[model samples]
Target: MDLHPIEIVGRHPGPKILILAGIHGDEYEPIAAVRRLAGQIDREQLTGKVTLVPIANHSAYLRHSRVGTDQLDLARTFPGSADGTPTQQVAHAITGLIQQSDLMIDLHTGGLAMEISPLVGYMLVSDPSTLQKQRQMATAFGLPIVWGTTASLPGRSLSAARDANVPAIYAEWGGGGGCQAAGVAAYTAGCLQVMAQCEMLPSPAAAAPVDRCVIEDDRDTSGHLQLNYPAPHAGFYEPTLPLDSTVRPGDELGRLHDPFTSHTTTIYSTQTGRLFTRRVLPPVEAGDCLAVILEDPAETGTTNE
Candidate 1:
């Protein structure tokens, strides 16, 4: 779990920015995006050091799964131990890198399990300056959505950033395995945009569109995508509505059918918002999160950097 990161240093001194990908091995877009960034970004065009970890979890990637051979989620084992399992060692190393940097951008996708809309997110931390920087980075990412959620969750790279007082943000794109060209391109430009926004790049990156959706929720469960729309029974799930569509309460999300028992159950939405996440894989266990509604958000309007 060495987590060998690529470091690009700028001619001039500036912030040390860390950009990570492949926290979950099945998420392919981020890995490709980071690799693209490494080739595109030149030290002469940058004002600070940019560290890129294209494949943060090699063990899982080798197995073509989300978790490592140790069966531990690297995302949930942050600030991990040097004397622990492989995933824990990887987490510990990444957390050390996060603490050593001034800013961070952790890229992600839904992996092989679900499909997620392209969006950038940050924790709703108590520090105003850090929160503001996070917002700036999210806007600069030039994605369709900007999500600010609760900062209380533990065992994450963002949590390590929160504790280290380092400004950080994560981006999610469409996922269901394989590298989506659009997602890779967006992520590549997004990282450069963030560098420009932070004055690390000489050229100004493309500005985010006027109508980009911005949602900030500080509730305890704001960004937990795994808790929405639980399946009634273990079965094959088929979603009704498409991803990125708005849904009101009672809207049918999907159907669950117990393959052996032939029992079918239709799942409905419990909240109103965009359907940001929906399980793409058919088989699911009882209580597995089937759909995730973003919860109707009163637009925060165009956020300034």
Candidate 2:
């Protein structure tokens, strides 16, 4: 297999932390943040190694879609097959890097139709050892919000590293697509802090503690989300709480209907939690998703404040 060239700007030594971004391709914030971080890294601060693969999925990135050219989710094709499709080849290359890594931080962002907070995402595995390491890495970043994913078991993107006994965590921020200024800053700072934790950099800035929440892996945990704002009939969508609000069942999140005909329909939260994502464009179809609940705070520990 031809090795994908990963750029390095650190001194030769110490622990190695692999910062991978763009597994999904269209998630622009992570790629942008990596670019910004790469430009500012001091190679002399010398200690451990820091290797960055800012764009892992070249085809998906080029197409501006989540899936690669083969319509395969690159994140799921771990320890990939060399003789398989192109997506698998890319996955194999990434897995090789992770195998040699001491720690890893996969950067990500919400995609297509939803936005997620600038938070650290760690898979909540049942394995005691894995869980412990995940927690340690989660706390190390110190972002204001930590999101745990209980789904996508041991064969996904970072799974190879975790299986190899490496401590890795995924960091996410900004979204619907493109680099949001604040999100870029948050991710860059968090990434550096993680590198410092591994001694890849000296005296990296302190990371602010973020609220921790579990994004339950269930029938609803989707890699690419589509939030449909349905209209009871058809009209302009007038929203009340912008996307990503802490809401409760029966709480009116927005209203939709005929603005010209005066036919109004109120959108209510189906679950109690924060509204982390929604449709940016207004207007809706009958029975469409007005908004989505990220987690039910009481059971999930998510907070909007």
Candidate 3:
């Protein structure tokens, strides 16, 4: 695995912030954002080091697919074995880089199949202090939403960082394998804000006020805001609502139609939230994720409006 590490060292020593992108090859907004940022930074004015990996999964990036040539997802192979598959090797190298950073940000999007809204997320750690650190970083990223999950699932890039006790956040915005100007600009600006927050660079004169929505894991309750809607059966999907559309419970999300059987099923929203993700591909398979519903922060009383 060939790792492209773009490092910018400042005149004065400070925290090291690592920004990673292209973990999923089909997501291009973050890669472009990071590359643009790398070109704009003035090293002489910077106080710390900044490392940017514009394309984390080179093979998948070339193919414009989520998985690499080895038929593996790089995001799920963190803390990987030294002698392992190609994806695993890449994961190991990425983990090593995370270990060397004071703060980290993993950039992601919905990829080829779906579109996503801009959001920042951190992993829920065992220690209160560590979790607090993660929260601060996520909040500082200036995204409207901040989500925290308990434990990193095996092989996830953030899992390695969590295990290392590093403060990190994952950012998602834009998707469908195409670049959006707004998405790229938002990501680039957000990266700069994070660097300023880390004290790696001077703070901007007027930082944008973030209307934050905090999502925490509470599995025991039905009020959990983050929700995933999977394909009920294999068919062609046609979404009823646009991405980022606000909805109430019982709202029709889309329809899944079986061409061969002439059967149609309507997908409905179970809770009040924003439609952050929706599958763009017409072909679907049973158990495939079709849409992601995020509970409205106002309804959940988690909004900083």
Best by TM-score: 1
lDDT by residue (1-305, candidate 3, tens digit) is 56878999999999898899999899999999989989988999999899999999999999989899899988878887678988889998999999998888898888888877788887767878878878877877788878776573567777888888888888888677679898888888888877887787888667668788787753332222223788888999999999888988799999999999979999999878778778888898887778888764445764322
Clashes counted in candidate 3 amount to 1
Worst 10 residues of 2 by lDDT: 216-225
Q: What is the lDDT of candidate 3?
A: 0.82
Local accuracy of candidate 1 as per-residue lDDT tens digits, 57-134: 999999888899999989989889999999999998999999999999999999998999899999999999999999
**Model 1 TM-score (2 dp):** 0.95
Better of 1 and 3 by lDDT: 1
The number of clashing residue pairs in each candidate reads 1, 9, 1
Give RMSD to native, each candidate: 3.3, 4.9, 3.5
- Model 1 C-alpha lDDT versus the unseen true structure: 0.89
Please list the residue runs of candidate 2 whose C-alpha ends up more than 4 Å from where it truly belongs after superposition: 1-4, 7-12, 126-129, 151-155, 206-240, 253-267, 281-292, 296-305
Kindly give the stretch of ten consecutive residues in candidate 3 with the minimal lDDT sum: 218-227
- Error (Å) of candidate 1 at residue 113 is 1.1
Clashes of 2: 9
